[model samples]
Target chain A: GAGVSQSPSNKVTEKGKDVELRCDPISGHTALYWYRQSLGQGLEFLIYFQGNSAPDKSGLPSDRFSAERTGGSVSTLTIQRTQQEDSAVYLCASSPRASSGSNEQFFGPGTRLTVL
Target chain B: SQQGEEDPQALSIQEGENATMNCSYKTSINNLQWYRQNSGRGLVHLILIRSNEREKHSGRLRVTLDTSKKSSSLLITASRAADTASYFCARRYSGAGSYQLTFGKGTKLSVIP
Candidate 1:
């Protein structure tokens, strides 16, 4: 009955540092996605993982952005050499499945990352 | 690139009045979903309409999809002050190997009590 949850609701780090954001999808969810929202940029898809495989990583802006899901449950998004442009709200979402019939994705509160 | 584009960047209305938002996309989609975000927090899924459905309703929310025009609209009837927030439309591209939902710029709605 629990919804998707993310850790470190807010994170502040200096430029050139690395940050890892965690996401715990709802129970039984088989698909997880990570997105970033910046001012005036709207929602940008970063990466998606289904079960244990990540089929799509094209949306990831650069090599610094990487995500991995373990045991088909939790996922972690890591930003390496974080730049000021990477400052934004990192969102996590989970869906029952990736099929067309189950297209709904429940989102989490998000981790607000600030690069100083 | 963002798939959906919301018009009337912002709207203000009195309570009990209706609010309508439109979204336009560039590609054919399998489904279109509406979401609401309060302030700067996470987004809440409002509803989804498949490509074959012309219109669908859930409570006070009414959604219409036009595949020929590549657009969609969300109508909220008798809105309340609590409904003030940002509304976004996301598109599920109609193809395999790329099912990511692309979101729009969003419309900021302000409801006065």
Candidate 2:
């Protein structure tokens, strides 16, 4: 009964650098999501994957941001040429499904990305 | 654009006292969920209230939704000091064959013992 897990707990990189954050969703969880949280702010949805359907990329802030959920179990969020404003905590969450009946998402310990 | 906005950005109350947080959203939603976060880490799901339901309760937490007003409220009874954390209200809407949640700024609750 492991929960969702994320890698790199903390990452510090220079501006214009690229970083890849990883997430491992709970077993059997078919819905995965990525979000960014700025200091003292709310979570900003980034992307979402459900089963084998096309991923929702409407929330990605810019073209530099991209994510892929391989094998429908693990997801990777990639931010290219990171900007100072991109510095924030990246969170991952997963749920049993995307249905309204089971939409409660379990979150993972986020990776704190600092673009200096 | 953020869909939900929470009121009273911060709140302070004594232990054992009740606390209330409110959220207002711009669009119609399928459900509203509340989450608690500590130290800016992962958020823990607190409760979820559907648009059809007026009110729901779990333990000391009570959530109420008013689809007509596009608003909801979360109340915690007999709160303890451990309840201090950031409480966020996320609006769940269905679109593009998926359900996604948009979160508000959140309310920072400080329960003083």
Q: List where candidate 1 sits over 4 angstroms from the true fold.
A: none
The backbone clash count of each candidate, in order, is: 0, 0
The C-alpha local distance difference test score for the whole of candidate 2 amounts to 0.93
Q: What is the DockQ of candidate 1?
A: 0.76
Deviating ranges (above 4 Å) for candidate 2: B94-98
**Each model's TM-score, in the order given?**
0.96, 0.96
Question: How close to the true structure is residue A66 of candidate 1, measured as C-alpha lDDT?
Answer: 90
Q: Pick the candidate with the highest DockQ.
A: 2
lDDT of 2 by residue, A1-116 (tens): 99999998999999999999999999999999999999999999999999999999998999999999999999999999999999999999999998847499999999999999
Which 10-residue span in candidate 2 chain B carries the lowest summed lDDT?
B91-100
Q: What is the lDDT of residue A115 in candidate 2?
A: 97
lDDT of 1 by residue, A2-69 (tens): 99999999999999999999999999998889999997556898888887664589889999989888
Q: TM-score for candidate 1, please give it.
A: 0.96
